[model samples]
Target: MKQYTLLLAEDEPFLGKVVKESLEKKGYAVMLAPDGKQAWQLYTSFEFDMCILDVMMPYKDGFTLAAQIRQANPKIPLMFLTAKADIRDVTQGYASGGNDYLKKPFSLDELFLRVAELLKRASPENQPADEFTIGSYSFSPKRQELKDSDGTIVKLSHKESQLLVLLLQNKNLVMDRKATLLKLWGDDNFFNTRNMDVYITRLRKKLHKDPAIEIVNIRGFGYKLIC
Candidate 1:
C-alpha cells in the first residue's frame, strides 16, 4: 500500500503528538512542526501530499506559511485548524488559500475524515508524464530531474518538482495565487507570500539557461509558465 506524506503544523505539544500518532496509526507518514516557521521549513525541505496548518503560532503564522507554500507548489491540498469560528475568521482562512477549515475542540474522527478527504482530493489527477520537454530543458517528473541539451542535469527539490509538474499540467492557463497557496503551503499569509517569492526566484534561476522557458508573474493574479 502507498503511504501519503502529511505535514502537520501545530504549536500545542499534546495536540500535536495526538494528531501525529493518530495519523501514523492510519499508515500515513506524518511530520510534525511545532511552529509555523518550522512547518514552512519542513514543507520546503520534503515532499508532502497534504498540509494541515494551525492558524495561530509563534515566529510565523499559519496563513503566512501557507501563502509561501502556494507560491512554490500550487496544486497541493491545504486545510486549516483553528479555534476561531467566526464568519470573518473562516472567510479570512479561505482567502488565505485554505481549501477547508476545521474549528478547534473537534473530535479525532472529524480530523481523520478531513485528512482523508483532502488526501483523496489531492491524489494525482492522471497518470504521471514520463518525460517533458520545455524549451531546451527535458524534465522527467517521475525522477524529479531536468536535463539540458548539453547533458547538464539539474536536480529539483520536491516542491520545485511538484510546482513544475503543476505548471506543465495546466500549461497556458493562469494558475491563480490563492489556488496555488491553498494547494502548496496550506494557507496564505504575509510570511508565506515572502517564502513563495524566494522559491520563485530559485526556480527562475534554475531555468535561466533556457530563454524560451519563462515563469511570468501576472501582477495581481498568479504565475504563467511560457515555453
Candidate 2:
C-alpha cells in the first residue's frame, strides 16, 4: 500500500504518541509536532497529504495555524482533534478551513475511519471538474481558469479556485461541513468557520450572474453545488 503522509499536531505528549503509533500501524507515514509552531514549520517545509491538529497548544493556537496553512495551500486536508464542544467552537472550526472536527476522547476506530474517509474523498483522481460547465461559466482544472460563455475570463484566488473546484466536483451532493473545512482550512475552529462562510458568500455572488448555478446551504450540514 502507498504510504500516505500525515502531519499530527498535538501538545499532549502521551496522546500524540498514541495517535502517531496508531496511524503508523495503519500504514500511514506520520510526522508528529508537539505544538502549533512546530506544526506550521513542518507543514511549510515538507509535503503531507493531510493535517490533524489539536486546538489548544503552546505558541500559536490551532485556528491560527490552520488559517496560515489555508493561505498557503487550500486543498490540503485538515482535521481538528480538540476537547471543545461548544457550538461556537464547532462553527469556528468549520469556518477556519477545517474539513472535519473530531472531538477529543474519541474512539481510535472512529479516528481511523475519519482519516480514511477524508483521504478517499480528497484523492486527486476523484476531484470534480476534471472540467466543469456552469451555464456561461466554464472551468478546466487542468488549466485552472474560469471563462464565461463569451470567453471572458474571471480570475480566481487559489482558495477560491479550490473551493469552486470542490463544489463542482461534488455537484448536487451535500458537501459535509466538516469535510469541506478539513479539506481546505486544516482545522475546524470558530474563526475559520466564519472565514468559510465569507468564502461561501463570495462564491455565491460570483456565480450569481449565471442563473443555472447555485450554492445551496444544507442547514446544519454543508453546501450543495447545483448547475
Candidate 3:
C-alpha cells in the first residue's frame, strides 16, 4: 500500500486539475473529487493519508464534509483549500475538524509543503512517544486527543495537536512565532498570523480546564506553554 495517498476535493476545474497534477508529480497518488458529495463517497470507498478540500462545493461544503470525515476517522489529517479568509471561516474550518488552512491562489510549493508537513506528523515513523503527560492532562499525539483531570476527553485538530506538541517540546521556553509559522504554514503572513491567533484562543479555551497549563504570550516574541 502507498503511504501517502491523498484525496483532494476542489470545485474549480482548473485549480483541481492543476493541483492534482502537481501532487501526482510530487509522488502523491491523489483522488480528485469535484464536489463534497462525491468527495465523501470517495472517502468512504478508500483510505487516504490526508485530505485537501475546498470550502465551497456544489453538493456539500467542505466544513460539512470534514465533519463527516472526522466522525469516521478523527486522526486523518485534513486541510481546507479555499479563497475564504474571514476569521469566521477559519474558525469554522478548524471547528469542522480541519488540521490546516490554505487560502486559495496559493502556490503549489506552499500546498506541497503543508500537505507534506501534515503527512509527516501523521506518519507512524515520524511519531515519537505517542502520549505525553502535562499538567494533569494526558495528550495522545497519535490520537489527537487530550484527557483532562476530570476524565473529559478533548479532541484536537491537526494544527492544534502540532502546536501543543511544539509547545510541550519547548516547555517553559518561548516558542518563536516566525519560526513556528514558517514551519507550519510556509509563511508568516498577516492572514496566517490572524489564523494562528484564533487557534491559540481555541487551545487556551480547551486547556482552561487545567489551570496549570498556560500558553503565555511573550510580547514581541511568541508563546510559552507553562507546564
Pick the lDDT winner. Answer: 3
**Strongest candidate by TM-score:** 3
lDDT of 3 at 52: 94
Off by over 4 Å in 1: 126-227
TM-score, candidate number 1 = 0.56
lDDT, model 3, position 76: 96
On TM-score, the stronger of 1 and 2 is 2
lDDT values of the candidates? 0.83, 0.85, 0.88
Writing each residue's lDDT as its tens digit, candidate 3 over 116-196 gives 888877887766578999888999988999899889999999889888888888899999998788656645889878878
Query: lDDT (0-100) at residue 88 of candidate 2?
Result: 84
Q: Give me the displacement of residue 134 in model 3, in angstroms.
A: 7.2
The candidate 2 region of ten consecutive residues with least summed lDDT is: 182-191
Candidate 1 or 3, higher TM-score?
A: 3
TM-score of each: 0.56, 0.62, 0.70
lDDT (10s digit) by residue, model 1, range 104-126: 88898978877886777667656
